[model samples]
Target chain A: MTTQEDIRSTTADRHGFSEVGPDDTEAYVELQQSLAFTRLRSRSRRYLVSMAALFLAVFAGIVALMSWTSEPQGGSSVAGIDLTLVLAAGLLVLPCVVTVIHLVYTRRRLDPLAEIVRAQFERSRR
Target chain B: MIFSLIILLVVSRLGRARDTCSDFYVGDRTFTSRQNGLALFGTFTMMTSFVSLSDQIAWHGRRGVLLAAGFAVSWLVTLLLVAEPLRNTGRYTLGDALSLRMRARPVRMAAGTVTLVVSFLYMTIQLVAASNLLALLLGLDGAAARPLIILTIAGLTATTVYYTGMRGTTWTQIINAALLLTAVLVLAGALLVYYRFDVARLFGEAVGGATTSGRDLSGPAPTGHRSPQPLEMSSQVLTVMVGHAVLPYLFIRFLTVPGTRDVRRSVSWAIWLITPYYLLIVLIGFGAAALVRPGGLLASPDQHSPVVALLAVELGGVPMRMFVASVVFTTIVAVTAGLALVTAASFTRDIQLNLTDRRDGGERHEVSVARRAVVVICLLLAGVAILFVDANLTFLMSLDVTMAASSIFPALLFAWFWRRFNTVGALCCLYGGVAVTLALVTFSPAVSGDPLALFPGADFAYLPWRHVGLVSIPASFLLGYLGAVVSSERNDAKYAVMQVRALTGIGAAEAVTTSPALAAADGEPGAPRSRRWLPRQRRQH
Candidate 1:
């Protein structure tokens, strides 16, 4: 039931970014405009897009490969099993592979940048 | 079974003393990452994932395997896109996060309505699946026995959600998830041991059996010799992968943890658990095909789900059957409780509270209404399950996921990331996405035309594809953009605050700590804000 102004004031007071002081609008704008956050945001955005594309590619590739070879009997066999089953097996493992890669990238690249952003926010408050 | 029921009741009883809204909705936000992770695991891996999936694989071959993989892929979607940012923004539900930037009441009403619809559909699906599986387990085939079993399940789900709320539901899910995982591992291990740890042989046997049995081998149809069109398969996969990330029950789990790190940790835990779980499911499905007789495994169309039961009988005997059945029953109850809890939460916290103008003792009133909502929702679920006891509901499950993906997923993404997204845009995304999906589903092969569709007698299906997600998902994102562009409302300042809070979790804790309801319930109306809300261990690091 709070008015728009009340909400804005509350938000500002809660965040209390040091440089922005009591200015609610500037607090968020300033933080977003900071160099560390901008870098982190861009890096995170790139990572997200790439990982998503990679997952879609692998997923689509498996589905396409399976469909292209859907023969009357079994499509083809690797050793004793059908090629469709082998690729489907690959589909089962696809998420695990993608998740591991995501975690590694997040930890190695994104996490450090996020830390920098946090430290910058803290330092500015002082 | 009786013993586990007693334990669940005890946990719920202990939680009943704290009847605050926060406690009811999210266990007062006190669960550790591991606990919430297990709950998330249980919530996502429902009866369909455990029984129906492997059954589909056993009977349908590659199609089933693809579906199972799609389920696991969903966890990855949640991990990458949803968990952390949502955890930072939302206090209880998806509506809370959306309401931060837009007009609160209308957004909540829309989100709550969708949440209720999806939850109801999913709950009914779970209830029917559970009753059927339990009937198969107990060797009960009569119509009379099914209604009885449905009632029992509904009763158990209602008890768990009504008495314990989230606290009780979390504990129940944690227990069931562990047991379900153990059951799958044992079943898979038995299969592996039987094959002398040679997976190639298992696959070989499965392929050989399917060919010799003269079945489709690569598609869902039992008699047809065609693979699903690539578009059809891709659409189904996309439906599950995109849709699952926004399922209200699963999405709400992101809000239960205390902080961002915990959110990431928990989703990570869920992904790790689910990955191996799906891998094992693929094995078990093949094992069922390889080991169980085709006549026994595919006796009736309704008997597709008992592949696991048949496999257990083949592996051990009656004792193994009973053990697997118990695990399935517990899994069903745990997942049902989660659905009920979320449904109730959406009703009271999002719909009712927003629609009304009352602010006095709203927290207590909300908790009261939520409890009643659990009872009402469970009763309705039981009734719908009875009505659809004989119908094929596998389509309904897909529809629920598609609905969530089309509606909530687009709205949440745009709201959190797109600064231009306003109330009008969000409303358009939410309602428009839902409308488009439902319209497509109405005309899709899943509802008619196809022999296995919901209405096989009708032939009005215009949409070639079965799943609506392929079209509706992109349409929703487009609608969001178009809606925003059409509206003059802009909230760059609010978006600034939301972006900062979502990315950094800077002011996120205040949403919880300064909750008017929580403050009143705790008798701390003027409680000073503190950094104690931060994860102490994570902060130290």
Candidate 2:
């Protein structure tokens, strides 16, 4: 039986490609362990956690308010709509607003670190 | 209808595909962020957005808003977490990214089978929906008309995929998105004009109408509802969010761009487009609830609601209704074309080429196989659609989404971020997660013992919830972690290389041979390897 590795090697040889050499592997390990890569990973984890928390809090808030508060308090209304309903709808659109902000922030904050990692990879090629 | 059909044919023809796997699978990595973004928007906003969602809101106001919110937030989760790394890692399918770490045929086979299952389910739903709409439009009824419409749609979908491949599909989807957005905007504007441009008036009337019908506009659904329970609402939201991120058809769109930056741009464009689209959907849903009444155009008395079409008729007239219906028809066909293309690519690349160890030189045979696969898959989908023509297939769609969230989502999460994940863990996650989700759903209320169940006469519902993802998703993550730790196999060095490549996107967009060429630093010392292996250097070769 032909294993997948054998098949990959045969295909690689036929396509004039060499597998990753030890030198390249070493460089990859070094880059993976570097300070910039570490910082990037930490920052990514922070961003992921914060975004999840934000979404869950808003989503849970909407569900609780919608389920528990069946009738509006004091018969008050936001623009002739129930305050809870308006709040639910507004909360639903909040993530979209936050997404735009997050995208801009991600590009601003993360791009430089990504560039630093790229420069490190460049230096390793020497 | 005739005009829309002509436009679809022209759009598919404009794709002008080349006979290479790269061109067929990822559009030769040539699409700009704007083009791919529009295509992503089109691919995602399926029949649910156009027909079923508004219908839900017309009937069940609170639930509809939640579902729409789930969809909007899900795309953000995808953009922030999955899009950039997935674009940097995979070439053609989800299998490529997973196989990079596993290096096994079983892993690819499992991924391919899941992709086939998910896409097949989604495709059948779209076909059944479009045929139902077409049947209503032509005033055709009965079983014969349904099958005939299914066959017509299946034929058109296959033809589009055969001619356009990915490039044509993308072009077709871009047109579909533009047309859909315009139709929806016009409908919403018409509704607004009817309400004298008062957003508050629209909301007040919608609430009044729903309240008059004994349904609260700001509370939980009925306890005996066929949907998921109120307690499990958060899980349902999470399921949609996670499932949307890893949908096989939408997932493949990430790899159709040239680099990491384009991937980010593509998703950003999709975010801006999709956010506004969902907002309009909210307005349209409420408009349907406020304006439409019993025995209206939504009087099809079918499971799928042509609520948007009904609202159009009420707001504008017959001609506007036809225009909106045509746009929905085109949207369905475009989405089915995309699903068919993805399933074919998965079959050709993951199963036939990788699993069977096929060694065709130059991949010409692979392209041929993909084209053939499209016809076979569409035929099979048509048969399945006919079988479930009268059944309520929302359960199947829910199951499909759960399967995606439970299986692919966990596997990709672990493989990308977790360092100790190995071949065993991946296989276990793929096969085990799918099996658990299937078993749970089979025994859950979704399959039996409820009004909307596949077998309402049967009573074997061991689980109370309609969506099994609440349990299966967390179980999948745990299975992956335990599978990784239980086995002693580890590939730290390979993980290092993959991690580097995934983060920086150094050698992601090239043929396999070019990757090693970029790493060639052994012989020459005149210049740095990165400079020597730049695009200018590669072109000189």
**Local distance difference test values of all predictions, in order:** 0.77, 0.76
**Across residues B169-213, which tens digit of lDDT does each residue of candidate 1 receive?**
887788788988999999999999999998888877886787677
Q: Candidate 2 lDDT, tens digit per residue, A1-126?
A: 222332333223222222455566667678889999889878878987897788778777877777676663236687666676676567557766777777787778776787788778777777
Query: Residue B300 in candidate 2 has what lDDT?
Result: 65
lDDT of 2 at B357: 49
What is the Cα-based TM-score of model 2? 0.90
Docking quality category of candidate 1 according to DockQ thresholds: acceptable
TM-score of each: 0.89, 0.90
Write the residue-wise lDDT of candidate 2 on B410-512 in tens digits: 9998888888898788877888888999999999888999877899899999888887788999999988889889987676766776787777775576422
Regions of model 2 farther than 4 Å from truth: A1-22, A70-74, B7-15, B222-228, B294-301, B510-541
What does the lDDT read for residue A91 in candidate 2? 59
Off by over 4 Å in 1: A1-25, A69-83, A115-126, B3-6, B9-13, B218-227, B510-541
In model 1, state the lDDT of residue B489.
73
Find the candidate with the highest lDDT and give its number: 1
